[model samples]
Target: MYKILAVDDEIEILKVIDEFLTQAGFMVKIAQDAEAGLEILAKEKPDLLILDMRMPGIGGEGLLRELSRKKIDIPAIILTGYARTDAGLGFVKKDSLKILVKPVNLSILLETVNECLRGKRDGQTKDPDC
Candidate 1:
């Protein structure tokens, strides 16, 4: 089972994500904000991270930048309520699999998670010649 870290300031959002991802066969961890999320990341090192762009302190973009600086390569799917213009899409790198604008469709979130897990698995399996 894939391990996932889901971070959002809203308690309901964290609960929903935990329930949905757990039902989908992932081991899910929840964090209320970016600081908590980073603490969890330090210990768990989840296979994927689901982040909310807007939070009380150390927002998603800042967390992502910190992760990058620390050389953490975990794949991420960011959730944002703000408009793309205000949020500045530049924070999301091309390597990130998805950026879901709130309110997110559950189906799309599930699909993105599956796709990211698949990509991780595929990357781990390599041809001997390559």
Candidate 2:
């Protein structure tokens, strides 16, 4: 099973992601915030990262910047409730990773997980089956 680390400040969202991804046959770990996520990233090195775009202190954008600076190329799906503004777009535009607007659909999340784990990067498109 592919290992996934899901990071979100919202406990409810994290719980939902853990439950759904775990049931989908992906091993799941959750971090309540980006700092916690960094710790998990260092140790677990999950195959995919499901991140919330906003959080307290060093939000998802900040975390992505840090990863970029360190040259860590982990595939990430950034979910945000906020409107798709330039602020949210700036960081994600770099790697061709798509941002899923929240609240997200479970099937799409699974599809995205599958895509990222399969090494799909630049030039990714939506799976119609999802």
Candidate 3:
């Protein structure tokens, strides 16, 4: 089973994601903040990361930057209230990174997860099915 790490400040969101992904047969881990997420990253080394872009401290963007600085490469999906055209996401350089806005549908989330992981399996930036 693929290991997935989801980091969000909202406890409810984390719970929902954990339950959903777990039910989908993934080994899911949750972190309530970027700091905790970092610790989990070091220990768990998950295959994928589901990240909330906005948080109290060192939010999603910061975590991504830190990962880059550390030369850690992993597939990621970004959740944010911002739109696709949002200026806040300009710093993100990975072409394969998927950005899903808040109020994302569960089915779409599942589809994205499959596609992203499939790409990882195939050693590509994204699945051709995307």
Candidate 4:
């Protein structure tokens, strides 16, 4: 099973993602904040990361930037309530497979996750359907 790490400040959202992804046969890990997420990322090394763009401190973009600085490459999906053209999104765009606006559609999230994993297995940056 593909392992997935999701970081979000919203506990309810994390619970929903965990339940859905787990039901879909993925090993899911959730962190309530970026600091916790970083720890999990280092220890678990999940196949994909589903991150919320806004949080208390060291938000999703910050986390992604830190990963880049540390040379850690992982497929990512950014979930946000903000618009696609939000200025904060510019930094992490290159590393993200998709920028999904919240509240996210679970089915679409599942499809995107599958495509990301499939692309990784095929040694591609992204799937054609992504």
Candidate 5:
């Protein structure tokens, strides 16, 4: 099973994702914030990351930039309740970054995760072209 790390400040959001992804046959890890998420990234090297753009400590954009700087190329999907403009859409404009607006559809999220994993397996060097 693929390993996925979900980082969100909201406990309910993290719990929901952990439960849903677990039911989908993934090994899901939950991080309360970006700092914990980065720690998990270093130790777990998860196949995918699900992030929330807004959080108390280091936000999702900062985390993404840090990961890129560290050359950690794991695929990430950003979920946020904030408007795209307010959240600074530029950080996630990269092809590899998938942004899901809040109240995300679980089915869509699952499908996106599967697609990303498949792309990784097929040796697709670039991020999702969509």
Candidate 6:
């Protein structure tokens, strides 16, 4: 099973993601904030990261920037209700995948997650729909 690390400040959101991914046959890990997410990233090396764009400290963008600095190429799906604002742009890079708004559609999220994992397995560098 593909491992996933999902980070969000809201425990409810993390819980929702955990339940959904687990039902989809993934090994799911949850982090309540970015720092915890990073720690988990270093240790777990999940195949994918589902991150909330806004958090109390070192938000999703910060984590992704750190990942880039570390040369880690983990696939990611960023959730933001911000509508592509400048704050949300901090994490955009060549490998940008899906950026879902808050209250994400479960089916779309699932499709994107599956696509990301499949691309990883197929040796694709970027998600075509991005």
Candidate 6 clashing pairs, residues 3+ apart or interchain: none
Q: How many backbone clashes does every candidate have?
A: 0, 0, 0, 0, 0, 0
As for lDDT, the candidate ahead, 2 or 4, is 4
Model 2 scores a C-alpha lDDT of 0.79
Clashing pairs in 3: none
Candidate 1 — what's its lDDT? 0.81
TM-score of each: 0.87, 0.84, 0.88, 0.88, 0.88, 0.88
Look at candidate 1 and tell me the lDDT of residue 102: 88
Tens digits of per-residue lDDT for model 4, 1-130: 8899999999999999999999999999999999899999999999999999789899887888888789787888889998772465455546455778998999999988987788767988655544
Residue 59 lDDT in candidate 5 = 82
Instruction: Name the regions of candidate 4 deviating beyond 4 angstroms.
Output: 89-95, 123-130
Lowest-scoring 10 consecutive residues by lDDT in candidate 4?
Answer: 85-94
- What's the residue-level lDDT of 75 in candidate 5? 79
Superposed on all Cα atoms, model 6 deviates from the true structure by an RMSD in Å of: 2.0
User: Which lDDT tens digits does candidate 3 get at residues 1-130?
Assistant: 8899999999999999999999999999999999899999999999889999889899988888888789787778888887863366555555547878988898999989998899767887555443
**For each candidate, what is the lDDT?**
0.81, 0.79, 0.85, 0.85, 0.83, 0.83
RMSD versus native structure for model 1:
4.2
The weakest ten consecutive residues by lDDT in model 1 span 121-130
Candidate 2 Cα misplacement greater than 4 A, ranges: 85-96, 120-130
Worst 10 residues of 6 by lDDT: 85-94
TM-score of 2: 0.84
